[model samples]
Target: MACQSSLALGLLLLVSCVSWSSATDYTVGDSSGWATSVDYTTWTSGKTFNTGDTLTFNYGSGAHTVDEVSSSDYSSCSASNALSSDSSGTTKTTLKTSGTHYFICGIASHCSNGMKLSVTVAAAASPSTPSSPTTPSTSPGTTTPSTSPPATTTPTATTPSGSMSIGSVRDLAVIGLGGLMGFVLGVF
Candidate 1:
């Protein structure tokens, strides 16, 4: 009985950790896909990208090339000295650093027509020790209200379109295995 309980707890922990660490996969341009005529600047707005996240560019195989370039190349729509280039219709780039990354379409006139994208990735949040709560100091028998209003912020949500990422598939596989293990252990 104790063995089964421990197994269950271990399975729970595994599932939770997998879910928490699963990185997001953003489909560039959403439904419009990686192409000209799409406003990439607006597409990237309001989205908080983090390291470990992936950006998938979907386009016609021969129609366009996904080129990873420096800021100067992106600004000038130059693919002559691209850091990386792919014309395989689909390109998947994993953000490994915490800084801005730029991409542009290598096809002539494509990038100038707004087929360039620059995304700023933030470092992934890590687990930290909780800070102790502080109580406001007040004078004896004196109640003072805060002079300033509380600050509020709006969170942006992004949904991946068209396909599921490899990470998502792996997460599901882990969860399924955990369930199977639990079932077999229960029978034993």
Candidate 2:
């Protein structure tokens, strides 16, 4: 147990060393293909985005790639991060700019099947507050991750200058340990 926690702390330090930043991602195959390509594809149309936003593919999805077709195309997908093309079902490229983003499915006949999407994200109001992508669980139309926001009490105004430790782990591990703790304490 000590070894595992040590590993977790080590990993967290490594990642947190660099502030977290990502492009707003859009999943494929949603009913309307929001932030997705044509109906069955990924990349939504005219979905305003800014620098640092990303569009990631889903598990076991297709071999798709996002790229800028030409000079006048997808300024968002250009210059700063002119990624020619990438094939990763788990993660895709980030939209580092705001412009017409033209991406196509580089896989065979995928484009022909209308597996393409273009979106024009407006200039980011502020770089520090980049748009965050919505997850599938909280999918707009899905019943899960529903519209109702969690209830919570407001925090009191306060100031602090010190840092503290936090135990962050995969959800399953957290839940399993939580159950064990509750059972042992006779609170379950």
Candidate 3:
């Protein structure tokens, strides 16, 4: 009975972790939205964008326009030949690929006054590598090395400071819910 309960608890935890690891939605400029007097560069400095995440631009209608432009257009702050433009005061763009996406306001002198945003999206989540194994010793002062090759580890990516990851928050919530369910099932 004890072993079965442990197994069930472990499975529940695994399922919770897997379900929370997914895409997230980010509101640009937070409450300030896409408008003048807001420093978009500083606003997005601490966020880690990933492919499939959504970027939402919120602003007043007719006051500003969101234009998806090329790197050249972004550099020049020119929206005359933008790839796409939206003036609905709210725009949502899903990061379809792992690359840099540039956006700017088509209004006069808006892009020049820090009304542009450049988001760099990373690739989808890859399988995490296990920890490296330590060398074993037979005696306290004497050790024998094995013929096995050294383990290679991939550096884990960390979210930026002052920013919360959507997955991390959801993961915690899922874990708590799993624990509650386990307790109700007498698996605690």
lDDT value, residue 146 of candidate 3: 53
Misplaced by over 4 Å in model 2 are: 1-23, 28-46, 59-67, 71-83, 126-188
lDDT of all predictions: 0.83, 0.49, 0.84
Instruction: State each model's C-alpha RMSD to the native.
Output: 8.0, 17.2, 7.2
Q: Which stretches of model 3 miss by more than 4 angstroms? A: 1-21, 128-146, 152-154, 159-188
Instruction: Please give the distance, in angstroms, between residue 149's alpha carbon in candidate 1 and its true position after superposition.
Output: 28
Query: What's the TM-score of every candidate structure?
Result: 0.63, 0.39, 0.64
Worst 10 residues of 3 by lDDT: 162-171
lDDT by residue for model 2 (1-188), tens:
76556556655654553343433455544433322345632335434455667766553345455444543333222322443665555546577777766665555555555655565655654224334545545556658634554444433322133622122223334565555455545632
lDDT of 3 by residue, 116-180 (tens): 99999988767677777676658778758656867777565576677556556765777777776
Q: If ranked by TM-score, best first, what sequence of candidates would result?
A: 3, 1, 2
TM-score leader: 3
lDDT score for residue 84 of model 3: 93
Model 2: how far residue 54 lies from native, Å: 1.3
